[model samples]
Target: MDREFRYTQKDFNRARAFLLQLTGIKLADSKDSLVYSRLVPRLRKLQLEDVRRYVDYLEQHPEEEEHFINALTTNLTSFFREPHHFDILSEFIQRGEVVNRVWCAASSTGEEPYSIAMTLVNVAGGFASSAQVIASDIDSNVLRHASDGIYPLEKVNPLNNKKLFFKRGVGVNAGKARVCAQLRKLLEFQKINLLDEEYPVKAGLDVIFCRNVMIYFDKDTQEKILLKLLSKLRTGGLYIAGHSENFSHFSHLMKPIGRTAYIKL
Candidate 1:
């Protein structure tokens, strides 16, 4: 088996089809280089000679599915990446609403959910104690990192309440920060593929943060995922989306309340 595997169009198509089937993420033809870069490492690790062999291995070994998904999925995220949504959340909390359960649907590397947790802790007033957030993503590797709750110091330095939600490392551990125990207690990290017919989360969610993820899917897949997410959202509950997303198709079910934020009517 050669380590320098040449990924052909056929190889790219096969891998793309399998990924789309499993995760509903339609890889564009232009992603040929990106696919090659991500999957070649997998080929080497699995002792396979080429992309075709790797695809065959994927079909034969269902258990390798998680590794395959972990390899291809993108997990770009940051704390409070969209600050406006958090502002809306703060206002929602202040309104004395019944917001007990929150869901960070694409909780890549834990930033979005942690930001949600910080908002609840800081702005939810007394209601923060009873609230819980479920943070999930398709990538098992990123889920592990999210659970660890450690980030570089610079990531949290901009946050106003950095000292409250994160513990700044000292002595030998300087220049690093870890999520404090109080904030970590409010979040649960799990592996969830939105392509699934149904999620394991409890219904009546108060807030759903399905951010910066749907942009990877086509229209049909996006609509299906939105419908499922809406079913889990309780009446008057909020749904936060990435700034670039447009849920105009589901306007009958939800009304826009703010920039990329919606409320179930």
Candidate 2:
């Protein structure tokens, strides 16, 4: 069959439904162009001219689901993406009110969790001695990269010549920075799907960095996840989200003390 290169409204609807079923990301009709733009590379890579054929191939090959998810998911994150949250975290640690197990719920590619580790190391005084950073993501591929603890120099641009926390190297694998063994020792990366059952952590966390991840879920799912996170948060713990995300709906459960940052009451 000659693959249909051009996408129609039907194709857009089908793709949207498939993605929604697979990842719960709602793609509105207006996003048809965006979907086409993102999926075109996948089509080209597979050498398939038709979107329908690509969809069919995906249905038969379940393992390729992750590739589709990675292609569609927007992972715009950075070390200390929102600096104020880290400031709040530093303050929380100074209060000395709880255990220091920090969970970076959507630790895409490790920057956020690593940033948390660096902040705690810088400001926690003796608290860093006991602090543990757990970084988790649903995407195994990104989690592997995070666990490796190596990043392109550009990715760590926010470090701002702070060579104390990282070691710069140049050889056959030149132009890359790696987290020093001391810093990497403080981090643990795992593959976690938040949409599944409430995550089980061995210890109650002092801070939950669920940043920028809840925006993808529907209102009900967001509330459900928020409640689950709250359950794991020790009293006086902090829960941080993306700048664009708010817990106004769950204001009863969390007290907002700063911009996009919340404290469990």
Candidate 3:
């Protein structure tokens, strides 16, 4: 929908600066149109006349910050979106002698953590019965959906062990599935901003699946985040990244042990 609002270069700059200041996402100049398109709905919803006015409203109303962040943040995730990582996770569990604590640092819409939970459940008997998974994200909106554990039937069809982890809906709830209570019990969904200096998780996490979200940050922010994630991981623990994220430059903190997977050294 074309916004009945004016979106000027100055306004775009202001919006970009605001997003960066709040979310640590540095938008490229080319993203001006993208930002305009994304925020136009916000302006319409708030009955604001222009991007400049929306900025003013945001500055005045700090409570709207969550809505602003939610509006711009992208939440594209699915169960077992990256299958190879799950394979690596399974291997790690098989070789481990102790119980593992896993954290899905950017658990957008809960798919990655759910996938991790499925793997954990598969190996629970032989690997370790005490394994736990924590799924977290900065966006409260997606976390709510993740916590609900409801997904469209088509979106979850690709999961490898469908019958084991999901219950397909029938009758009035047809064409959807709810994550079975057994699998859902393994995950604790919460809100977590990566830019924060400290996380609430305990030390010595055995696995941290922080996929796809790092591409949004610049090199400096990426390094800072890497350090924080590494600190939370135990020695010989694993840190999984998105296939597109190349952290080879930070060899001091972690070394690549598999495709887009690293071991805390």
Candidate 4:
């Protein structure tokens, strides 16, 4: 059957408001096209007339909020994506710095955290036995997938020489790979909303990979989250963000190294 399409302005407004209220992710008027495009499949699957009905159903059923959040949040990521950051991390580990604990604060679908795990395994050459990876995401659905340590084979394509970090599977799981048991053993996945007033973990981390998450928040919100993240980072530890993000305004708390990496001074 052909999918029906009907997205009115009122529907767009309702979805935008509902999403912002629930997740603090602001979807602007200009994003109407994007909103419609992303949610249309959901509407078709649910057999809803348009976006407004979908919003109403979501509001009435609080349990489905997670589904809405997962549908809307962009979780694009890759292993070793910005390889230079891992290079820096390997160098820091080579210097024998205290880095037993690392947090991938915005580890979407496990890529970033898994990438970190692979890097540790390579540099430490079995030294990761003493290390741990805390990988958190706001979306619980994605967190579940991350915890499973499974990914489509294509996602591991960017690992370069790090293919040994994963184990291939076939049959029902064909075209997929799971993080090596050793790497999976070191990773712990949790659901954490970055906008929360207090984060759960109090351990002072030696490094944090919060890349690509702050680009969605406003400047003040970005600073607030960054401050909270910095509080958990040990002195002289590092923080990395998306390549497009800048820390010129935060120079007082963090010193910019090269690229988008920062050191907490």
TM-scores, all candidates, are 0.95, 0.88, 0.94, 0.91
Per-residue lDDT of model 4, residues 224-261, tens digit only: 88999999999999888888889878899899887999
Give the candidates in order of lDDT, highest first: 1, 3, 4, 2
lDDT of each: 0.89, 0.80, 0.86, 0.83
| Winner by lDDT between candidate 4 and candidate 1 | 1
Candidate 3, pairs of clashing residues: none
Candidate 1 lDDT, 96-167, residue by residue in tens: 787789999989899999999888887855334778999999998899989999899889898887877888
Candidate order by TM-score, highest to lowest? Answer: 1, 3, 4, 2
2 against 3, candidate with superior TM-score: 3
> CA lDDT of 81 in candidate 2?
83
For all predictions, the C-alpha RMSD in Å is: 2.1, 2.9, 2.0, 2.4
Best by TM-score: 1
Error in Å for residue 65 of model 4: 1.3
For residue 123, give model 1's deviation from the true position in Å: 0.6
Looking at model 3, report the run of 10 residues with the lowest lDDT sum: 123-132
> Which stretch of 10 consecutive residues in model 1 shows the poorest summed lDDT?
121-130
When summed lDDT is taken over every stretch of 10 residues in candidate 2, the lowest stretch is 122-131
Judging by TM-score, tell me the better candidate of 3 and 4.
Answer: 3
Better of 1 and 4 by TM-score: 1
